[model samples]
Target: MMEEDDDVTQGVLLRCLSLYSRGGGCKVGATTSDEFGEIVGKSYKPVCGAQDTSVDCFSYGVEKFRKKNNKKKNFQLQEPNHNNNEMHVFLPDDILEMCLMRLPLTSLMNSRLVCKKWRSLTTTTRFMQMRRDGYYPSPWLFLFGTVKDGFCSRDIHAFDVSFNKWHKIEAEVLKGRFSFSVTSVHDNIYLVGGCSILGKMDRNSSKTHRGVLVFSPMTKSWHKVASMKHARSKPVLGVYKVNSNHLTIKSQHNNFFRTRQRIGGVSDVYEDPHRLSVRRVSRTSFEDQKSKQSKVNKSVKDCRRFLIIAAGGFGSWDEPLDSCEIYDSSSNKWTEIQQLPVDFGVVCSAVVCNGIFYVYSESNKLAAYDIGLGYWARVQTTPPPPQVHEYTPRLVSCDDRQLFMVSVSWCEGDGEIGRRNKAVRKLWELDFEYLTWNEVCVHPDAPMDWNSVFVADKNLIFGVEMFKIFGQVLEFLTMCDVSDPKMNWVHVSKNQVAREMDVSSCVMKSMAVVHL
Candidate 1:
């Protein structure tokens, strides 16, 4: 209710901001003139504000103006054609932004198209960083519906946690009759191998090839990169930062020690980028992917470039895989990892946290594959996550070592639309490092009959709900802090802000923290 009250309050103030500019004044009868300013001021103070003196002086002016003309008047209407400069009231940018802050995130994001001033505010990295930090928001989720006609396309949607609205982005680079395998590392989308279903001119269509396509909302363009070894399907693209050492060459005159510091983590993925190997038969023997094919790529005394893994997403629904493979960029090859036990099977939904990988079984069980130990052990499932609705679980993301997944029980569950989710919606968490799982439940009943879930940071999960097997209609996202037992699971934005999501270009494969 307080949030709703905030919406009403901001609505009234924004109405005033537009009118406040006109000869007509603003009304504070129901809304406090300084209230909105104070709210937005808090969001910008420490970051966007330059100095205390400037901030203080600007704040005072807005407050003074409010006190002078407290009455509300519509901005669109002229105020008796007054020529007096006395009514020329203006507030500093800092204070005005404070009011804007109070408005819901959806309003704030859409404010970009409102006018030049709003566009400037939305596009600025400083304001964006401030928003991310202050709100502890999650990255956006770009989802695509079903694919057909030998052609596949999905909309790119960003779920802004701060504003709680989903925005649709339409772009040309996403056209193809190909399958999608995507992931979000940083704020970008990595779209991997897909064969075109239709057009003869469709690039990479029909034939399987390994070519990587990437999309970053910040840059808003798709770029191609190296290809993979084989044409793969339903590849679960997991993006993680690889920590490498920062190098510094020292002159012979002075003795230098290896910095061992990292040049910084750049985003890379398990791409099937063998643009050269598309339909070609093996130049070398094709080893079964289920075996542990990872040899010590270089075991060099200096650096061990980390390996990224991909597993069990090939074949048709009836013959889904249990095979897994890892790639070492240093070696430029794919190493098939040890397969899971017959019961555990290959992880249907799993994510890497810190350095450990927590892979969830399709059944009610889960296990951790120790990268260092080279073994996969079965873990117990007490509050067994409700059985995965389909072959895959909703999501798998790690918060430190605490893993979070939104599992569904198909026996029964209804979304807000009064339709039953193929699986009943429920929020579940597990501290994988400790082998402990939280049974406490939260809701906004996920808006999915079948949506790929991605870790949207701690206590939050987001995914796409398809209108059909091929059309995406809605996006489901929610935060369940539950730090206070009293708070069950507050719906951040599902039906409310998600209405603006663009489902057309959603490439069912990618996930973002919050749509930029």
Candidate 2:
């Protein structure tokens, strides 16, 4: 009887394996011994058991096969017995990795604690590359907020696109910082040019620094890189590829300069279009001299890959600056570039696409800077929708080699002729070749007050809204797939932490999307 029971359990286990191996096409009762052998590529004998019985051999082991009656016997699977060595089944590492890759990111992180092998397997660079290449995980949206205390909160929230869930990330490095610009390069988040306040009680100790902080979602750690030469606050930041041949100092000259003369007791170089010009100092400051000398002396030490471009921001004296700088990853140095056109009001939004740096100013004017030619051009496209505020328009680059602009406008209420009652949001695509703008779609269901919006993987668009209700601030996330013709906006859930904490005094700072 014991031997019969063991034979029945073994046959059931083999049948379960055959079902998985055949992708669930093999029927239990219909699969004869010869057919089962062909499915598993192994010879096995069929034991007498109930035809309707099913077992999940992957999760739980077979303890015993019970006999129910004289004519018909029922087979049952029970909890795994650790002491029963004969029932243990081992899968190949490759198969185990395939299963692990299918799990959600949060579950995959928890799976690392299962055993040393799993922990090691998931941490491997090859495994991460494989999972990323396979597109098993969706891009994650990261949201940052600042409280009334003038400091960024340490607790950041990330939204999982695949599971529509929120996960808390404790970014202790961002604590006590404010006014920093956040951007991502190659899936790594960069916090650049912010003021660091040391003591909560002492507001006079606030100091602006040029430090750059990098946060890696994969390792969940923070590290500092070489600081910029000139400290800036809320600077325009973007990434562009710098060609080796374009590194000559002559290219840094004012190509748009029509004439150079003294204006208002300061040397200035004037441009023809829009009367845009940059002020040139008669006597250079120490930093200005060093910048000029570096421009002349600095040689291309290695093949340049990509550069981090930082432009127009408030300088240390609380005055608006038109100076620009670029950070070369190959040399870990920040070199001064051509200054932004004078009187180009505060840079509200910036993006890099097709080797060009595009900046939208507070005056509702769009300008493009060609990295290769080392010059700037005012983009004279169709005017944006009426009354679109500077911060309301967001520039996003898509996978189709297209530039998209998202902006929000206020519409008058139906009851009142002039009173604005509703907010309307629309998307526009840019024809880069012809320098034209075309309307794409209108998102009617999006939140009226969107604090931040960003694109992920060049295909998905995420919009984040935060508002105070019942003295508690809650964050809501919504997403839309740009590839779809409908471009329907799907609402993700509100943040779980926001529900628990009273963040009414907090305001959204920035948002980034990363794949982990």
Candidate 3:
């Protein structure tokens, strides 16, 4: 008798699911009330009425069973319905969150429109934290471009890795700006050092600004922040996080002792009978020095801030600058730092990994700046393959530990007599300890030209390809998973917004991956 009752309860749950899926209401007969109540607790009741009331009986029944069995779980159901024969279900907050978290990003976003409660639940801090920790959705690739008029395009195209679809985000704040460097830190996107028109009518009177604009995905708004001291155009921008744990007093102490030795060197040499007079220093001066040093150290160790490094860009006169500056979020100031190596030339690509800023220059040399140590050193590595011609290298950092290099080269294809030229792209991993490069994979179908390459979460590398046909430019996106053994290149679809723009005048500015 128990076995038959269990079978009947399972059948009822299946029927309810089928009805819900088909947009029909579930109706439980009087005969099955006993079995239904047995599954959904003794308090379960069905309501019969003219107005249709839909409920997720499938989830409700399972949750009730789990509770009755004393199974430890993270979620629980709400109070059971006691009115009417037509079942009206109300799910508890925890149970609803569990169901929503399993949805794909696109579906999850659409679920917000279902009702106010669902929207509020998904946007809660707890929900976002859980989603991020659980890696519910993959990262998105954002591509910024400029229209023919030299103004930043309002339409920002974002490609979803999991769904393989493109989404458009409007940037009304950046509509009138151009020549800005784009970088993302955590959840915020920064637009640094750009030129903007003074007014709508005075387009001829334009000026370069050191202002920084920040965009937040959660709020979908842009706001201006503290500007830089020097105006820069297309600067090499990177973000470094400084924590109290990383700052050490040992270095500060060593520097203080070095300064003391320098000051007392001559005084010590004149020691002897007059040593007491020569060694005597003002007590107030010593106390002031000690107090200043303590204050400086305390401020540095007390708060954590992100350092924005701006290096090597065009100055006001369109001259390439080797000067470098660092922006401190704590004090909201930009302090000039060590300049780039004279031989490094103009920086082509840069990335921050493990608190070190790595930049590749047009001179085909790679160099790294240690933010903590305040020093720069050129990275030594083997040259590109002999067959590669016109090699262009780009640096990408992944997971804050691994550094990968993507290079594109033109090569001659074998032909009977006349060889054809083709583009070949290769991926290499850098061993920072040994400063050696290991070839990861070679793309079989490389586009004629590559605009930018960026890494999304999970070691997925995306490359934007641009080529011209019939005097019009076209762009294509390709991706490769470094974690995959095959590591084959997969071609993603072209950007639909790019198709709508003036292809002849459109130029790709920057590409970055950020979690939404």
True-structure RMSD, every candidate: 16.1, 14.3, 14.9
Q: What TM-score, to 2 decimals, does candidate 2 have? A: 0.67
Give Cα-based local distance difference scores for all models.
0.46, 0.60, 0.61
In candidate 3, what are the lDDT values of residues 1-516, reduced to their tens digit? Answer: 752343233122222222223332222233222111111234543221112222333232343222222333222234447443333234457765776665545445544534445567778878876766666556767777556433446766666666566656667776766667887776678888966663341225656778998876644568877888789877888887665545421222343454466454543321221112322445466558658966876677434468888888777777788877777777677777666765888886787886678888877777777666554656666753322424446777776667887877556676546777867777888864345688888887554654554554547778776666666666778888777898888887674445444542233467777776
**Candidate 1 Cα lDDT to native:** 0.46
Candidate with the greatest lDDT versus the true structure: 3
Clash number for each model: 44, 0, 8
Question: Ranking under lDDT, best-scoring first?
Answer: 3, 2, 1
Clashing pairs in 2: none
57-104 in candidate 1: lDDT tens per residue?
123224432233345532232346575323233344566555444433
Q: CA shift at 187, candidate 3, in angstroms?
A: 2.8
Task: Show model 3 residue runs off by greater than 4 Å.
Answer: 1-90, 148-151, 198-206, 241-305, 328-333, 384-392, 412-418, 421-423, 504-506
User: How many clashing pairs does model 3 include?
Assistant: 8
Give me the runs in candidate 2 sitting further than 4 Å from their true place: 1-102, 148-151, 199-205, 241-305, 412-421, 445-451, 499-508
